[model samples]
Target: MGIPLDKAALVGLFLQTLFYGVFLTLYWLTLFVLLKKTGIQRQLLIPVGTLLLFIATAHLILEFVRALEAFVFQVNTLGADAYYSNLASPLALASLALYITQTILADGVVVWRCYMIHNRRLLVAILGCIVLLIYGTSGYYVVWSFSRTHPLGNTYISITIFYTLTMLISVSCTTLIAWRIYRTHRFIPKGLATFLPVFIVVVESGALYATSVLALLVATLTGSNAQYIMLTVIPPIVGITFCLIVLQVHFHVGGSPSEHSAKPRGILLRERGVRDTDFSNQPITVHITEETEIVQSDMMRGKNSQLDSEGVFQV
Candidate 1:
């Protein structure tokens, strides 16, 4: 007899599903906030945000299908009867289609953003061609797998390859951009730098959705309830936790003032005539002192001076 899902496993699965839904919603909301806050050109974010929105929608659809499947098959196993009854459902097929579309869109967005940021036009074109090839090949494999009732093997391999490539490209681009920005800017604002790593992790981890799909496929193939529970519960939890850690790190790093800013001398200088040359650039010290009846030789020394109320020489 096959191992059946027990009460604890059922509860665990329900909680995992709930968390997945909540996280997906949060991801969308966060993306919107970033879109509003980012100084990067609006055109760039549009494609990225659209891709994220589509992926979130796909996950929601997948969750719905899983919930419906659980309700019918788990609650009324005898009534459902068919081993692959859920597979036959229109909603299930629609969810699968959406998932595939989401994968393509996600990969495309990553490649496009990377190429755009790097100004690598030729490489971008090459990546675009690669995406098309992978997507087409994956679609063919998926169709063949479904037709032959062997989706588990073929779909898993194709999706994994696609996701791995996407993750590699995105991470490389993000790290390069961050490093370049750090090098070029004298003082990167705490807020911006803090926010960047979090953004990268969140976006890159979107590929975890593909991992979850592969896990589900494996569980289905093996008919293992334990495998299903493990696959469904672990990846999202780990991925989202990493995202939250990145966010927390950003908030702390960006929120706190630098040691240089916190110095006693810096505090005193703030009140003096000295002021930051450019608020956005490195802070430079400017000393203002009083000078009366400036000496001709000193004046000829090419040093600039300004007179103050006190009749004293100041430079």
Candidate 2:
């Protein structure tokens, strides 16, 4: 039989596949909900977002095919050499390539966030570039190792180093961003106050990914196939982390105190000798957007109320 179904490697991969499906579901569902709020039929359906979805879908498809071939077709029909060769096949290599792409893109998103939070600082950008080059080089080495006769024996050390470096970059950059946000805003909501040591980012993003990468790296170093089990789920974790950043930014709270007051209220303001603008003539979307923010102002029949709180109409 080609690698027994009950083997630790197979069982670990199976568990990972199930978790990957869960995270993949979360990614698309959250993406759709937030993007739908942007209106305009399909607003902000950007290239990076679309590419992430494509990569995730393609990865799942490849996993399904491989799983079927192993557990169904080759369950009792292959020897050891064929089993190992099957793993290093072209499709398997392509799958690893897909994972590398996903990691690069996810890391790019994290770096972009640091750039944005730091207001596009040149030094930060340069540092980010160097980190990415190192990460990419290491990632490529890991893939190349897969073609070797004994991939894990040849590459575990490098894999450990790669994930270690990855976790370091992720932790350091994320902490910097969170610290800056704290210095600027003075406080993040207590509800989102999880500033974990090495796995969390601003707004509690990316902890799962960082932690999983750490676990995978540790497993690799310990000379176990547990790393492969974690690999199946890491892509989806990366995508989910990227998606969480977008979701947090999208649902940011905005409005005045009275806008969020317990009492439902509206306002109208006018000035004497001023032309009355017909806002109703504007586009429906514009009007809808304008009305999204509740106005808290007082009406003045014949006097300027720009600073005065008299003759207020609460509608």
Candidate 3:
């Protein structure tokens, strides 16, 4: 018989798989609720969010399979070497393809929306075409890399460069847009502002890169099953946490105030028309005085009595 699996390793594997599944479930449920309530059917962030959810689901499935293989066969067939050489190759390629497609399309839509908002039709078309060309070329390269036997080196370099450039461009564009909105609106919604800072930190800190590096170091140095389990578990937890936070912020920002409040303030406007056309205009000033102190003309008193009878005016 091959080496028996450590009890602790088995427990960790089970818990990790369970946690991942829970995370994915929560994410999808939150996303569904947000979509229904917000009525924002199409957004760049939706695809990104979906991709993240997909990654988490796929990761959980992969881990579950590995755990089952170990438990049932009492063999280490799904070890690091097997993962890197066989399983990861195809998965990585697919992930890269999805990332490229989603990123390009999402970013293109954002750029197009920005241009349309600013009434830059000509520039929108030009920039849109350029985005398509860049994405097309990248897709071609990714397909070519996948077809080769030794695809890792070329694929890694291509994806790294593409992702780095895309991240930088996205960050710069989004920051500029946010700034423009702030300048024009004077008040950026609190949730949206919160999102920007968290997003900036996640991108700048290179959380994914750090996770990969830590995983590699752990796998190489100790070669322990516990380490392997921890490596698989931690990054997804962190990623899922961020995704949930983002979704929460989005939902909170999108919520209608009236829906949350029982007694919403109603706007009550009292207009005095100087002329027929002036009826459409708002009053320039409003003054409140005690009824005891104010003296009203007979005509004004009659108008006030009429208004009070109709319940159209209030002191």
Candidate 4:
């Protein structure tokens, strides 16, 4: 049983590597699409993408090291119990930390999006901050538990529960963002040919990470060995979900009729200083008067997804 468990871990690690390859490819394509479509804003985006790749690569390398430790080092020395025992080795600690960091960072990005989607309302922002604080605090304990060189009693289980909470925060914020975006998109009068795809991409991307986390949460709660496999797969998937959201938004919005028609269905970018991520944090409103119409139109749009305030079509 011990030998087979070790083998299962090894095989899981191998599959994780293969998954990494697929995601790495998507990351490059995502980066390229982001740069090409994002215009000057690529400065902020490139750094985020680079960080994602760096974290993802670190996860793979650290996991590979853990695999070696479990299979080669332990087998050659202390036998299979060493493989099963939760040794607080450097490689394991680093791997654990990397996974935690990836999940937290990805959640932060989604929370940021949620903040913006809610029009940067102080209430939403405050709630997001609270979520981050809780997530960070819980994650600290998780790492602290790992520092003991092994999970003491139910320490690992506690860590798993905390991790689930962190993921739930993501799903909650994602739901809010999606609902907000959907409500806003209901207003585009014509040539919505663009926003629908963006909407689908956003929803699907959110679903991607949401589903992964849900599965992760379920596996952890069920005490299945498959939890290890899910953990290995999640970091890259989170990174991919985020990049795809940014990439798809930029791709569809960048190539919209705004380029050819010179007026992009009345949607005009709001003047906000230094837009973060793909777009500004304010919803783009159309060039119109009539407060009633403006209010109605505003309900149908989101910030930073239109031409510059100067009326220049970016890219």
Q: Name the candidate that leads on TM-score.
A: 4
Using lDDT as the measure, the top candidate is: 4
Question: Which stretches of candidate 1 lie above 4 Å from their native place?
Answer: 1-21, 24-51, 58-62, 73-89, 128-132, 147-315
TM for every model, in the order presented, reads 0.50, 0.66, 0.46, 0.77
Backbone clashes in model 4, listed as residue pairs: 88-149, 282-303, 283-302, 283-303
For 173-239, candidate 4 gives per-residue lDDT tens digits of 7677656655555444342565466556666877788787787787667776666777788877876
lDDT of 1 by residue, 8-116 (tens): 2455457656766665655555455445543442344445445545554555556545655665656576332243343435554554455555545555654554454
lDDT for model 1: 0.45
Error of 4 at 154 (Å): 5.9
Regions of candidate 3 where Cα sits further than 4 Å from its true position: 1-32, 35-56, 59-79, 86-92, 95-129, 132-136, 152-156, 187-256, 259-315
> What would the per-residue lDDT of candidate 2 be over residues 1-315, giving only the tens digit for each residue?
233323544665566567666666766766675555433214433456667767866876776676667667886897432553455676677777787788878777677657655655778778987888887787778788786667767465666667887887788777766664444322222212222221122436756677888888877777665665666667777767765555444333232323333453222223344333334555432232222222221112112311111001000
TM-score between model 2 and native: 0.66
Please provide the root mean square deviation of candidate 3 (C-alpha atoms, Å).
14.0
What lDDT score goes with residue 6 in model 4?
Answer: 59
Q: What's the lDDT for candidate 4?
A: 0.65
Global fold similarity of model 4 (TM-score): 0.77
Mark the regions of model 2 whose C-alpha exceeds 4 Å error after superposition: 1-13, 33-45, 79-87, 148-154, 187-203, 252-315
